[model samples]
Target chain A: MKFVDIITTAIANSFRSKLRTGLTVIAIFIGAFTLTITSGIGTGVTSYINSQVSAIGAADVLTVSKAGDATATADDGPAPYDPDKATAISLGNGSRPGSTIQALTDADLGTIEATSGIVGVDPAVQVTPDYIEYDDSGKFELTVNAAATLTTADLAAGEQLDNESTTDQILLPTTYLDTLGFSTPESAIGETVTIGIADFAGTQQQVPATVVGVQNETILGAGAGLNQPLTDRLHAVELSGTPAGAPQSYATATARFDLDASDAEITAIKADLADQGYAAQTVADQIGSFETVINVIIGVLNAFAVIALIAAGFGIINTLLMSVQERTREIGLMKAMGMNGGRVYALFSTEAVFIGFLGSALGALVAVGVGSLVSNILATTVFENLPGLQVVQFAPSSIAIIIGVVMLIAFLAGTLPARAAARQNPIDALRYE
Target chain B: MTVPVLSAQNIGKSYGSGANRFDALKGVSVDIRAGESIAIVGKSGSGKSTLMHLLALLDDPDSGALLVEGTDAKKLKGKEVNRLRNQDFGFVFQQFFLTANASVLDNVVLPLKIAGVGPKERRARGMKALEQLELADKAKNKAMNLSGGQKQRAVIARALVNNPKVIFADEPTGNLDTTTGAVVEDILFSLNRDKGITLIIVTHDIDLAARCDRQIFIRDGLEDVTRSPEAIEKPAGAHA
Candidate 1:
């Protein structure tokens, strides 16, 4: 018989016992649905993390701090503090309480910039702006970060803060737009605003800067971003009355290295810096723990999906074996009519594969439909703060792979019953009551 | 004068072994020519069905040669045997063995499908076979809805679809009423006479055996050679 005919006939026969076939299909559907949903969640989360990592800073930039003493441990009693190294700083996300690295100073920044493979070093200067105000609008408290100069903003409107511009520029957060008397992000672009800050003498000083852009809220948190020129003005105003003999200290420093450097090259740079009592971490290092947690969660979910699929595989075997038993006389008749053993085997195997196709196709369609709906609802309610996260996203290639894998499992399970049917004695089967 | 269409030479077949060994057919030989209607008559367990299976190439003989045309049946490959059966032999069983869920037309076209005939061609041939059996109007009906007589006729339609050189009927009329049985018997004989298609019937009914051109009486796994020639020479339609 023709191969096409065998497949078409097998597909028709699968629906002969509607209840039995539908139950088996539902079993497979459970596995496929879980697999597709978990896979989408994994894709959605990892892609969002990746975008956040890129937003933090350029890949080549490394956060550098003073390394702890070689022999110091948490169990050790507090030691006498030296004046030059008493300052402390905290690394964000996944850091333990009381985990602080000694702060860097101007002398340390110069040393890092002069080191081999180090191109640029920008000190992490702290700036506190009391409030910002537009024409006739009341002042609103605003948080400004000088580190924003080393980072890129996820913009909602206008361009990114221009680090190279000699003129003072600021990237405003979307939350402050309405309070600043701007109706929209686009309307605030290129408009000037006054930032009030108290100097060391307790006198308030007002600095005027033009808005460069407006940025959307991200998972990392959103704040006003000050470019190098605007940050220098704020720093100068905040330290006007401080003593001249006091040493300048910083929370941390951003150092740039070769963009195309190999892992070994970067590691070697870290080792050199360690010898000079400094420590360095890349963006991936700061975000690596988060990725690990997400991966572990996804792996556990996938394990459950695999278990469900294996159980469904046994369901396919049971269903086909029963079908073979019920159709013994029909099998004998076909064999007697010149259908060969191989064709008989093909017919049953095709039936099993058809069942897999039905369940997986239905499951994937419903998953994409429901998953998108859930993501949409969550985006506006629970995940409202995260603007660009889809929460669940489907990749076409992964969906295809899931379907192919389920079909393969069905084929393996079918081999036993198909072989039994193929090897049946025509005379005996014909005599079967 | 012409070569016999099927020849069996000292064929033997047995079932079981050791304590339960039973020889279904010890030594049976017969020759059937093209266009001849022959019956092998016996009681149940007399090996008439076993001998028919050997001649039909469905089972292998333990000893001696069974030949189709001129080639020994044992010499043909498995696929060749299947092809020969598909193209050259048709079967009608007392059980009717139709897929009840399938339409009557689908049941009738089974042999043509196994032969890999195109859909349009098989449909036309299948419909023609049904028309010949006077079942053209029931082609769309489910096989389960057919009466015993109509079911037997549908089986005949399936048998005729492939236009085989021979038709094997094993108790074809055993499940039908007397009137319908007569009608089925007439159709088998007329096909042998008009189309020159050979007929091999296995039946225990004496009246049906007498309708054939010749009868081979099998008793105790062997042919009864002592049967009188006059019994074998009885004319068709001589019995009710």
Candidate 2:
């Protein structure tokens, strides 16, 4: 028989027993549905982590901090250091490292810059920008949330703050336009705004800077950009007038290396720096643990989904065997009419594949719909504290892979029954009651 | 004489071995000519149906040579055998083996489809054969919906759809009443007479045997023609 005719006949015969085939399809649906959702969770979380890590800085830049004598747990935020008393520094994420880390002396700075492969070094000083005003507006408290030099940020208006420019320039976030009485990001361009922060002696100090651009923030993280001039101004005011804290030191140190350096050379430089009692990390190193944790969770979830798919494969075997038994006489009649054994085998196998397709396509489509809806709701509720976090994500390639896997399982399940149908003796089948 | 359309010589087959052993056909042989209507009448378990199956190439004999249109059928390849069964032979069984779920048109189209005929031509030939059997109008009806005579006619249409050279009916009317059986027999005989198609019937009914041009009898797995002196005088070694 022609392949087309075999396919048509197989399709016609699948409906010969609808209820049994439907039950088998349902089993596969449960498996595919669970698999798609679990993969979505993996995609969504890891994608969010990627955005967070990117927000930290470019690949060639590392945050360096002083390593301390005392061992610190992984959760230790940052080591507190006092210049007057001796203290060891184990600087980590967002921290600068050294023992009793004092202000980086000119001598220390020269030594850091002289390190091989060290192209540049910028000291980071954390300062709280407490209050702000535009022109003659009333003073409104604001948070200068993680203002840093961003390598990649989508802009709403104007150009990026030039990091090489000596002018004190800050980039305004998209949300601040309405709050600061600016009708639009375009209107806020090149406008001067005053920022208030506490001086070293605990006095309210107001500093003015120009807004060079406006930035679009994502759901996970957003930040303002500050060039060297602006960051230096904030640090100077923060250190002046004898603030309550005893001495001066940097919160973190940003180091630049050749972006084209090989991974091995970069690793060597980091090891040398670590030997100097300093911890150094690229953005990926900071977030590598996050990737591991999410992947493990996704792996466990997928195990359950695989188990469901295995169960569904058994259902396929049971369904096809019953179909073969019920069609015994019909099979005999077809063979007598000159249908070959191979064609008979193909006919049954096609039925199995068709069932697999029905279940997987339906399950994947429904999973996308349901998973997206749930993730959207969580975006506003459960994940309200974290911006740009998609709890569940779906990819087209993942969907294709899921369907392919399910079909493979179904094909394997059908083999035994299809062979049995092909090998049936026509005379005996005809005589079967 | 023209070469017999089908010839089986000294055909033999056995069942289970050891104490349960039994010969189904021991040296059974027959030659059937084109357009000839013949019968192998016998009591139950007398090897009548076994010989028919061997002749139809549905089963292989333990030891024998079978020929079709003078070709040594035993030497034909598997594909060639299937092609001959699809194109040159048709069968009608006592139970009228039509798929109960399929429509009459679909049932009749089965043989031609298996022969690899295209859909349009299979349907056209299937419809024409049903019309000849006076069952064309009921083509869309289910097989189980037809009465005994109508069901037999549908089965006949299915067998004829491929325009086979020979029709083998094994107790074709066994399950029907006398009047229905007579109608079925008339259709089979007319097909042989008008189309010049060979007819081979296997039955226990002497009256049905009387309608054929010649009848062969089988007793204890061997040929016996006590009722036909002409058959007894025929040369089994004519080709050999």
Candidate 3:
């Protein structure tokens, strides 16, 4: 018999029993759709993490942090700083000095740049203080830690802070404008801000500064008020007439290098930092705790999606079994008409696969819409607490994987039923009432 | 020397096993020649249907040899049996086993489709068969919508679609009224006369059996070929 005739007949027979066919299609659709959406979300989360990691620069970045001394580890809790050691090392007022504290310095940065396979290195200085206030309204004070001066090229908008300026000027992050309820970045520029610096005696003294420009904020770091709104944290104070006896607080000197830098070069940089008696840690080590939390969230979501997909598979089995029962005589007739077992199996499997394909397509579309809506809603409400973080992104690989999985599941679900139909004895089937 | 269209030897069939086993056919043998119309008259449970099934290759008989058009029926398997049934024998059941969902034309083309004829050829042969049965006008009508006599004619057209050498009618007119049965009987006889196709019919209708060229009486799975005076006298009285 012609293959066209068999296919056409199968399709026609399926249609002849419209309710059954519709229900079967729906079962497959639900399965495929669930897979598509879940996979889409998974893809979105992974891609979001990757982009954040990429912004930090390089996939192979491995960070190391200092391990505490025996006594501190035994204590396993926060400890008071050693004032005598802090004064000896000139590490602010009451900072503790430990054997593993390896600070990075300019010399260490230079050594890293000169190492084999090393590229450009950027050395940085960091300070932590609560020195942010607004002249317009004295209602709130912004408390922050860590500060850095970045070039205008790194900013999503506005000009960079001038290194040679005698005046106390600074650039704010875009997220700061959002926090201050300013409608746009331009409006936040040139704003006067009075920063309160805590002296050694723990008294607040005010320093006036002007906002020179505004920079865009990154999503991952936006919520924590870290890099964004740096104007308050990184105060551009007049240093020409400053007292020489002023204490150097807890400071960070960071180095940026090309992604292709070898592990040997990185190790050399670390060793050089240790030789300089400065403590250093990589960015990955600092964010390790955060990544673990994000991974757990992704895993939980995937598990739920997998359960739904399994349920959908059961639905397929039920629908296909029903179809087999209804088409018993038709199948027998086909067998009698010389349709081989393989051909019959292929026909039923094809129907199942087609159902899955359509369902997955529909599901992916729904996931995209849902992801966008949920992301936007969360950004406006729950995510409002965080300043510049993006939680979701459109991911194509995830969608493709979802489609592939749905097709595979649907094909597999149809196999047993199709085989059962094929294995039926033609004589018994013909005799079946 | 006319060729024997069908030959069966020592055909026996039984149901169940051991003590409960009951033989339906006990070593029955028969030969049917080309263009010969033979009626096998039997009471119920006489094994006539079993013999038809065996001859049609729809079922295999135990400890027997059966041949149709010189090909051994015992040797054929699976699709080969289907091919033999399609290419050599046409079967008409008392129930008129036309696909109720299909139109008359589709019903006729069913056997040709089974034989793997191309669509155009299948349709052409189907239409020709319908024309032969004078059911061409009802070609597009569903078999379910037809009268009992019309349905039988449609089934006959389906049976003849592949141009088989022999046609088997197992009480083809059993479900019809006397007037409709007469019409069906006339069509069957005309096919045998005009197409020279051998016909074998199993029936309990004495009037129907009288129309055939030859009749064999079956009782308790055994054939009595001896012409009884009563059987000869009945046909003569019907003619008078």
Kindly report, for each predicted structure in the order presented, the TM-score of its chain A compared with the true chain A.
0.90, 0.82, 0.67
Residue B37 Cα positional deviation in candidate 2, in Å, after optimal superposition: 2.7
Q: State the displacement of the C-alpha of residue A248, model 2, in Å, after optimal TM-score superposition.
A: 6.0
Model 2 regions more than 4 Å off: A40-57, A65-116, A135-142, A145-147, A154-159, A172-189, A213-225, A241-252, A270-279, A285-289, A372-394, B17-22, B70-74, B224-240
Would you list the rank order by DockQ, best first?
1, 2, 3
DockQ-based class of model 2: medium
Better of 2 and 3 by lDDT: 2
> Judged by DockQ cut-offs, is candidate 3 incorrect, acceptable, medium or high?
acceptable
lDDT (10s digit) by residue, model 3, range A1-433: 5667656655555565567667666665565555555555555555555544444533343332222233556557855785433332233323455422433344445555564433455433333445466645443445332232322223544555654566666566655665555677777667777666554445556666677766555444331123333333343322223467654322343445456666666666667655544444556554565567766776787677677667777666777788788768767655654456777787777666666676677777776777678878877898775433445556787778877887788789889888998887654565577
Structural similarity to truth (TM-score) of each candidate: 0.91, 0.85, 0.72
lDDT of 2 by residue, B34-124 (tens): 9999999889899998888889888888988888889887788879888888888898988888888889999999998787789999989
Give the lowest summed-lDDT range of ten residues in model 2 chain A.
A85-94
**Model 1 regions more than 4 Å off:** A50-57, A66-87, A92-99, A105-115, A145-147, A200-203, A244-248, A270-279, A284-289, B226-240
Better of 1 and 3 by DockQ: 1
Ranking by TM-score: 1, 2, 3
Q: Which candidate should be chosen as best, given DockQ against the real structure?
A: 1
